[model samples]
Target: MLDRKTFAEININNYIHNINFIKNKTKTEVIPVLKADAYGHGATQLAKVVENIGIKLIAVAFLGEGINIKKNGVNIETLVFNYATPKSIKENIDGYIYTIGSLEQLTELINFFGKNIKKIKFHLNINTGMNRMGIDIYNLDKIISLIKEYNINIHGAYSHFATADNLDDFIKEQYNNFISAIKYIEDSNINIPVKHICNSAASLFFPEYSLDYVRPGIATYGMQPSDIKIEKELKPVLTWKSTVARVGLLKKGESVSYGRTYFAKETIPTATIPVGYADGYFRQLSNKGYVLIQGKRCNIIGRVCMDQFVVETTQLNNVKLGEEVILIGKQKDNIISAENLASLAGTINYDITSKITKRVPRIYIEEE
Candidate 1:
């Protein structure tokens, strides 16, 4: 066993299960997004697992991540969705598919490839309504002309949905706009092979727009994108656990942790957990977050330190050193889920998992 007070238990079985579940739901090809190190579940490891299940296409945020996946021996079609700087572009984007949205990116690729380019493929990102990335739909004429002008080997075309998880009216508007863009491509007779737009929530809720491919991120990790309801059983795949470093008796009126933010009204029991903001446990959870100690919920006390935090255990008897502390996972009849922590930290569930720093070791678990 690795000697560490904090570690993440990654359920490999559930990870595969979530992938199969997505494939079943879409009834089409599924491109699992492994950006942010598979949302901090270890991207390379997850890529191997994904490839084992016959998934050919994988998506990452940038070129470095795609290269890392390839370097780690994941021989599959990897797509880089985010923009790349002019300096970052190289002659050899081998074993990778790149996305180009703006004219600048297209020009950069054209300049790099020049006349005699071989087998490099790219996707055209159409900005339907996200307004974050992708070419503006209104500028489709220029985008098409540029693709043909440079004789770019376009493999796919896609757009990201702005509000697929919520706002039904916006979903309809964005879908229509995306369809209009695709119609333009068809009318122009541009035969792009792959076309996708639905994200995790979209794939779950909107089967009609699954298109040629569906990219699922958070749902691939078995977590709902938002509090919005989706009728599917996605097993929780991550369990953040730590050990009680020390147990102590607190005197009446004695404060705990930094800033003396928490004080005892009377003599109380407390346990120090060896996890804090440095480990991606948000400091905002100070005096607000709760953890499971001996199968019961305990309130966090005082300001969460950079490396340690204290939890009030006066409600429990015989709280001892080395007792299990569930930071984000089920413990007996109780649980502290990523969604719970995200709500407390005023962020999304993806932030909760993706921000888990590399300092903490991930222990992969696969049960029979």
Candidate 2:
């Protein structure tokens, strides 16, 4: 048994099931995006699971993440979605793919690599509508020109959908724009080996846009994009658990935690858990969130501290120290999913899970 007081149990079998389910549903290859350490689910461990499943590609948000995973032995085709620093661009990128969103970035790489540099694979990021990264659709001429001048290999081109989860019109517009970008690349006689755009939501809802590959981020972790009903089934893989540390009696008129945010209406029994915002438990969920203790939902009753929070266990009988507390997972018939926490925190499931700090150990449950 693990010695940690608070830990997240990661079910690797469920992860494999989700990926295989996705492949079966879409009939398209998947490039698991491990950005933000697989959204705080530990990217390196998940990467190994993905590798063992024979996935050819893995994507990360930045070069450093890709480099770290590579150094840790994730040697499959890793793609860095963000550009690297000029000094470190050539280091640790032997077989890695990089994203080039602008002509200037493309030019920078060409100037640094020079004409005699080895062929480095890169993907063109077309700005369909997100407007965060990617070259403007109108700048295809410049993109084509850069492709001609550089000796880099064009692996693929991709665009992100800003509203693929909800807005149908906007998603279609982005898809059309991506199609136009692809047409321009083809007209320029450029050979892009793989073309992709579908994220988790898009792949599940709009399979038409699942071009050559799909990069599933949150859905790969068994989460839906929104609260809407999903046709495909995906099982959650993470279960955050903590042990009760202390128990106390809160008398009426006495408050709990900082600022006296929670005042007991009457004498009540309370329990403390060794987890707080510092452990990625959101402070916003101070009063709104509830945890499952002894298969009963215990309401959090205080301002969430950096390392501790109190929960009202008055409704439970004989609550004791070292009992299992389910923070974000199913407890008997009830569940406290990331979606549930995110809803209370006024954020998405991605933020809920990714914000979980590394102080809490992640216990991998690998079932053969």
Candidate 3:
């Protein structure tokens, strides 16, 4: 039923499996992060799936994303991780939990909502060590003072771990800092019902810090957070695929694609797939990437173009037009993962999948 020559297949079963696996492993509430269109796997659809599975909350990076989820009729509580202006927050206040990281943002909320500020729900973001966002640990007293002054309704308090994947001492330091912030708030008679700091890596590797909730982003989408391996099984939820649009024989010394960076070493079969940098396939993968065709690995031959690229298909018995190609998935006994593409592109797995542009149709598949 797929009409597109190239598309990303979202395996719903695998996604559910990952959610269950993470929840079972951590034994805590899992707050699936659906930001960046659920890492380019299509957020609206995934949000619906998450709700159907009884997940009470999901998180996104922006207010607009949370609004989009609400507009789609997904009733789950959405937590917006990024700061929003007072005007923007007022306009889209329903069904969204905002992260209050700074005194300025908190003041804006108080000023905008006035007495009704108590109706607004939010979580306090504590800056343990990331230093990217959130209230500084030293300044927690000021934040607590303001919260007490306004009688703010803080639903939870959380922090982010910068090196959960690496499993360093810094993680413990960050956790300690988070715990201290929570204690400071509680000492001021402020009740923080839910507390969390573990991301995907920490959720799997450091269950002790799973606290009350785990905000898993990449790992929920079935991608490993880092190079370190975990014993738990997490199936990849996406498979990018395309079809060979053209096939031809390249003679020795003949080059392919832009920049002529690749010249045929000898006579070989070449295939052009309708995928390129514009489609989220990185140009850095120029000559280093490989695609699976007929269960064989076909080496990319030249500079990846904006709309198309050539691959040496000499390993196949016969290269045919419209033959299926696996861009990121299993073929026969071999598999090409997003991690593999990320390695070739000199990036991480998260970048590889999230960069897959919107042009590629996301075809959702669930086994019955």
Candidate 4:
């Protein structure tokens, strides 16, 4: 079936199980990171699914993303973790929540809603070491004064870690910085309501980073953050699969695909899959990857092409056209983990999960 390969199977029940498990693990509030379309698991679908389970706050990266989530008719509080642009003030001020990291932006925000209900809740992101966003602590007092003068509702104080996924010292440094800022905000009489610094990495390995709340993104999808030893159980909730398009035998010395990247030593069997990099499957996987088919390892024997890739199934017999192929996920008696694919691509689990393009269809399977 032309529609079979290149589709992602999303286990909705698995995702729900993950959220419940995370809730049990820590006392902190859960903020599921739904940005980048829930790491390409389909944002609107995920938002609706998680909403039923009662996530108080859902996060997106930009104004349009928040708008899209809101437009979906799910009534959860949406947080824009990324900065809001000046042009988007109407949208931001009207309904969307904003995070202010720069004094100039804060000034703009105050001016936009001058003399209005200035108690609009907002978050202040402090830049401890991420070198990304946030006002330095030196200007914290000045900003606090501005916030008070404008009567802005200081809802939360937050920051991002530079290396929470790594070893102890780096996370400690960021944690100290975050806690110090939290103290500064709380001690300033601002009545800040929430303080959070944990991303996926921090949520799992660094408990100290879990302040009033912590946001877990990739880890909730059942992928480990930073290869650290994890005591908690996790399972990948997504899998990619396709059907074999064709199968043929290659004679000895016969080359396969562009550049003749791989040549068979003996007569071997091969299967062609109808998915390629255009489907968000990385092209670099040519001759450098493997997939599970019929519960056995199928090796890519040549350069991956534009719309299809070939895998040699020499060890196994009777692989035929239209047989199910698993690019990611478990098959009978075997599995080719997403981590293995990420390792082959020189990236991490986050990239692998997020890179699956929108063009590919997703099927939500209710896990039993």
TM-score of 2: 0.97
lDDT of each: 0.86, 0.87, 0.89, 0.81
lDDT score, candidate 1: 0.86
lDDT string for model 3 (263-342, tens) is: 88799989998998898999999999999999999999999999998899777887788899999998899999888999
Give the best candidate by lDDT.
3
Q: Model 1, residue 304: what's the lDDT?
A: 86
- How would you encode candidate 2's per-residue C-alpha lDDT over 203-289 as one tens digit per residue? 888877788899989888998875775644888989999988998999999999998888989999999998999989999998889
Order of candidates by TM-score, top first?
3, 2, 1, 4
Candidates 1 and 4, the one with greater lDDT: 1
CA-only RMSD, every prediction: 1.5, 1.5, 1.3, 1.8
- On TM-score, the leading prediction is 3
